[model samples]
Target: MEYTLSPSVTIINNRQVLVSSSSPSPANDRRRRRRRRRSNGILHFPFVFSGLSLRFRSRAVVVAGAGSYGGYGSGGGSYCEFSCLNTPIEPATPAGRYLSSVLLNERKLFHDAVAETLEKLVKEVDEAYARKALTVDSSEAALHRRIAELKQQECKTSVEDVMYMLIFYKFSELRVHLVPPLSKCIYNNRLEILPSKDWELESIHSFEILEMIKEYLTFVIGWRSDFSVTESWATTKIKQANLCHIYTTSILFGYFLKSTTLRHQLEMSLADPIDDIIMNAYICRRKNLVFGHTHNKIPTSPFDGKRERENLVSYLTGFTSDSLAKCAQPNSKEALNLITKYSFALFGDVGSDKMISTSFATLKRLVLEAVAFGSFLWDSEEYVKTVYNLEEIN
Candidate 1:
């Protein structure tokens, strides 16, 4: 039997030996060498003495280093050096996009959880209200108890904790669903809640609604610019120590009108009172008015500096009109001077408890003082005449 070595094999022999074996009848020796090489050194031939020729003898003596083969060298030697032929391998399937999809799924799950909690709260409140209304008893003691229990339970469980649990569970579910290629693609893809084209209109509508709500809030908290003694005392000394509350209420009313068709109409109404004050002062200044003069001329007096100046001018003008100019005067300057002299006697009077009591009494009286004054002014011309008479008498 014969075995053929693979093409990977290479054979080499000494050139000197080949030339020595190429003498007469060299063909037979060459044939034997070829046969031996082809058979992978398995064929063994004993040397023949009679037929021994120099060529045959030379060929039979194998050179030690020259005899080497490439294919799977003998058992203990290195294996054959074959060309590396790489077979085609498929590319790895991607999992990056699927990760984002899983995250989105988790977000949706948590959102649903929060929504569920809000819905439950709404339902509980509604049910409690319904139960209270259905009861025929005058007092809703049982309903109150049930509501208290529900509130306690809800207070113990935070909305954030519920959302976190939902997110955990949803992530697990997403991982399971993403086993297939289609599921992975669907989950990872970006999902938009609203279409792009409708966004502008939606934004405009939202702003309009917000403006309407703000207007409604302003209307519910009304405003008054004219401060009443009663309102001031009630707010500062009795009810609460906050001036901002009254100021904010007044500003809100002004802003509320700006949102309506009544804006210009209200502005016209406000201009009347402002014009009255400015016009009266301008007319008085133009007339070169000199009022009465009242002075205590005492350094120890604690009268307000501004109030004293005002009183001095008032008295001096009265004196100029009555004595120097001989104009129609309201009353006697001596009596007015006497009244001004005694004004300092009204200070440093009340104790702490007395002050508080007086403040409370003053607040009560002032509560309806503005309304009464307005009523008196509107009712009759005689009322105004009486006020002028009283001023003249004083």
Candidate 2:
């Protein structure tokens, strides 16, 4: 017979089974009862809420015979229900946490201590160098000795020791001029301070050296390229221009060598050459009048007429400090005003041979005047500025 099972209930051949039942006595009844029991056992019924009758040989089996039924019985029921266990267990404390914090604090303190020690060492070194307790060569020798001692102590050279050595060395080199035999002192100081193996010198000429000093002077005075006549030419029209570029490059090379005295000397030499170039260019620009000749030929002479001569004199006077104040500030305002005034003075005035000749003479005079003025200015302002700047740096 077919059987269907439901939650907490069992059916055999569409009939419900009682959990408790007594055994049937007749052979037919016993056989029928055994068949029913076998069918019920196949259903595997669980505990039920309500009492249900189990048919055996057309008789009802009650709860009292549940144990005897064997398959569906009250004796098989559990006394207590089970439940699930679900809670998290706490982990044991880690041993490394406290140690790690202490280590971090110690490292920070060590870094701070090292930094303070370095600063003190630097200050002591600078004071010693200043007082001549350490000569440039001696200072360098000391550094080498110290480095060697540190290497022996630690069995290896550290980046920190190297850096400290470099700082002391640089400060000494920078202040070389303050010591005696300035050039030698500076050179020695630089050699001591800089890494010994990495220095190079450029090939240079004397004229070029002179020109460089002049340009350096102008640069310090705040002369803008746009305001100068040299900027207008594609080529360096004057020899001083070429010289200046060369000298400036050379001086820069000396700076790399850490030779303060050599650098100063180069700068000092430039004063005369720079003055001459600036003056000549200024005068040439002032007489640059485009004369419209009757023959349609360009006039060779720049200053021809009485009016041009008067104009030239007036232009020169206007460049004076008092006159420049009517225009702008510092000395640059006067210089710029002079450049502008002269630039416009000769614009498009065409005239006769006599006028052209006069203009040419005026141009020559202006050039000569500029040269003299430049020479004096270079020796005075440019020289002072360079020396002062170097002093400040040291």
How many clashes does the backbone of model 2 have? Answer: 16
lDDT of 1 by residue, 1-394 (tens): 1111111111123210100111112443465456546854221211111111111111121111211122222334333222111101111111211222333565444433444444554456566666665763757768676775675344222222232233223323323110111111111121111111222211212343334323222122111223354532222121111111221221222222222212222222234443454444333332221110111011221222223232221222333222321111113222122112111111111122211111222221221221121111111112112211112332
lDDT string, candidate 2, 1-394, tens digits: 1111111224545733223211112342365446446754221111210222212132221111001110111223311111111000011112122222322355334323433433444444445445443444664767655654443333111212322222212222222111111111112112011111111111111343333333322222212223333321112111222222222222222221222222233333334453454445433432321110111112222222212222221232334333322121112222222222221221111121111111111122222222222322222222222212111210
Question: Model 2 segments beyond 4 Å from truth?
Answer: 1-334, 341-355, 359-363, 377-394
lDDT of each: 0.24, 0.24
RMSD of each: 53.6, 51.4
Which window of 10 residues has the lowest lDDT sum in candidate 2?
Answer: 82-91
Q: How accurate is candidate 1 locally (lDDT)?
A: 0.24
Number of backbone collisions per candidate: 11, 16
For model 1, give the 10-residue run with minimal summed lDDT: 84-93
TM-score of 1: 0.15
